[model samples]
Target: MAAHRARRWSLGGFVLLVSTAVVAAFAFLTTGPSADRADAATTALTWSDEFNGPAGSAPDPGKWTLESGGSGNGNHELQYYRDSRDNAALDGDGNLVITARKNTDTGLRCWYGPCQYTSARLNTARTFTQAYGHFEARVKVPRGQGMWPAFWMLGDDLGTAGWPSSGEIDIMENVGYEPGVVHGTVHGPGYSGGGGIGASYTLPGGAAFADGFHVFAVDWSPEKITWSVDGATYQTRTPADLGGKKWVYDHPFFLILNLAVGGDWPGSPNAGTAFPQTMTIDYVRVSASGGSSGNGGATRTGAVKGIGGMCVDVAGASTADRTPIQLHDCTGVDAQKWTLGGDGTVRALGKCLDVRGASTTDGTPVQLYTCNGTKAQQWAYTSARDLTNIGADKCLDTKGGSSADGTPLQIRTCTGAAHQKWTLA
Candidate 1:
């Protein structure tokens, strides 16, 4: 796929690193509000690694490829990137250290033959690819004036379809100057990037990214791409923006880890810039389970209108009671202001449309008021094609248990119930 061009402000000098603070890493996600067929037990997790043994023979041919060139692919920094062992090394310590050393190779032309430094660009392009799945990586970067390290994934169909056409998701990108701040960006049609191409997320503590490794992840699906660090989700985007350009991301993609030196990103290296800057990759993984498709659990898709019954951007809301509430129109009202969430339970008013305070006794009206902090609001759907409210031990029931609207949705005990259980219907 073609690389997307956007206005990128050299933030290497702008973002100041935090010098004092406690490091607290945590992910905010619900574990067991209820049980579903797709519970942790039924799912499986898969894994893979570069595993170059001890010699570090230039990223495995089965797992990765070296992207070559020094033509300043837009970001106008200086170092020529090479695919040699000196730059990309794998030691017995179980780490892939891609270094950007101030050396130079002369075999090639380009007049100024061997310059000052070379970096490595590697990717898992040929072996296998994936789409709409979970991806995560743990890495530690190097610090200095010109060092720029990125842990990201790109669409493989780029050569045929250009950028802004084939989507790009940047999980973590850090510059030496801005040590503690990390960037999470998305590139596509309208959400086109460049002038500061993406966004920046800073840690409370001024922990230089070059000092320690951090876990970066992406929960991607057919609907959107969410970028998180240590479990804190920071960015998300929908299909409408890129689908118009031909939803290239709907297909599979691979992983890439590169420690670039002097690109258009971090500006040219300064005299103070350190030599042999390195980026260490602990591991890269992809998971096929534990996710949310943004389908509002009901799978009821006709025309998404309001928030609560009110606000405009359900895209920005996230909380227990505050979630996208399928509403009627755009009148300025609290009920209209819907907050969308990663968790499946969809809410509008303060509370969840739970089985009436978790009362399994039949005819529990699905009400929305305020959050009562009880199990009644907990809901779960299973792969067994069933839906249940764990607290009350009941299933969502349709009035007369019919599939018609205004059937007055409620909750009833499960008894091999069909209408009572659902799968996004």
Candidate 2:
């Protein structure tokens, strides 16, 4: 057999430079204080598959397709890939389980030798591929010697350009020998196989990854790619980290999930290894950086312009707890940036606009508090320009109906007063 090359990929050779017009257009649409802040504080759910079907059901064909064969996959793997439900099926508990089982049947064939195991590899290459955005998956990986499970992406031009040139983003890759560690890597020309640019993150407290489901995600853009496990970011790769090599992850890529029995990196499973190892996947989601289409009930974040054209600001631009939230000059500062969340909360400085102590009486001061999902933090920025606090049943008011720059904000009965009227910029 030929040397089984470790599967890897690269970004394309062509460079598509960003134009000034395109940057200006993106800046105008996205909600950010400055034009260079392309990664604004908004995301539109573009695609997702929850795999929430009944027990023994196959994955939705509309969203995924199985890649079957015993071609060794350039890794001299031991498993014979198959498109059968026996290898991949949904467990009643809202998960897609891809199982690698010991194949004991006689006369079974594989590229290297007798087919000793069977497994499944699934991809969304045809159904969905995206360029820049956030891609995430929740998975509980199986454990044992030689157990290799991965959640990764490949450049859309794989058919023509092929590996090492099509660009590959390995969001999550686990080799059972290192049960507590997982890797995130990128492959491209001159950086394929053992030469890929990447990093690894170990679970805290020396915990095995099989202990529970964990989220693996990546924030991909033209400038960089950030990998995180759960909510903690571990590594970020940028053009400067490429060691003067060409950066190739500027185009669209498709998602792939697979569990392999034995591969070059993990070696072959031994007698101590367990049979029927399974990897459970909860869901895969992709989000894009763009303006809301108003179709998914997505929230809008921007400056809340009020009377006298001043902005609803966080006092002293502070993130400190119990910071006074008042009206100030509209300067497009972070303190003035507010997101009218779908959950009915006006959030800024990573906290919610809250009525002090959830008070119901008039003239109670408004403050920025840690978001607790309480009713006091809930608000409705209506078309009539009133920011009403639901728990207090009062409108956000400027104290004494003052339009001064340093006036404090409070909650009062909804009386349609000029102080209660506000506009979102």
In terms of lDDT, the poorest run of 10 residues in model 2 is 17-26
Best by TM-score: 2
- Write one digit per residue (lDDT tens) for candidate 2, span 278-322: 999999987665544432234456788777888899989876678
Q: At residue 240, what lDDT does model 2 achieve?
A: 94
Give one digit per residue, the lDDT tens place, for model 1 in 1-425: 11233522122111110111111111112233344322332212233563546856556553566665555545654556677888887876778888888765565322234556778777654433455556888888888877778877656554444455556777888876788888877765555555213457777777777778888888877777787888988777665544455445565555667776665457668888868788988888764443332322212211223112222222222322323322233444333332212233433422234555456687776655333335666555545444466677776555564543223556677766555544321
> In order, what lDDT does every prediction score?
0.55, 0.76
Point out where model 1 deviates above 4 Å. 1-43, 50-52, 108-114, 195-198, 239-248, 290-425
State in Å the error of residue 345, model 1: 32
After aligning candidate 1 to the native by TM-score, how far in Å is the CA of 94 from where it should be?
0.9
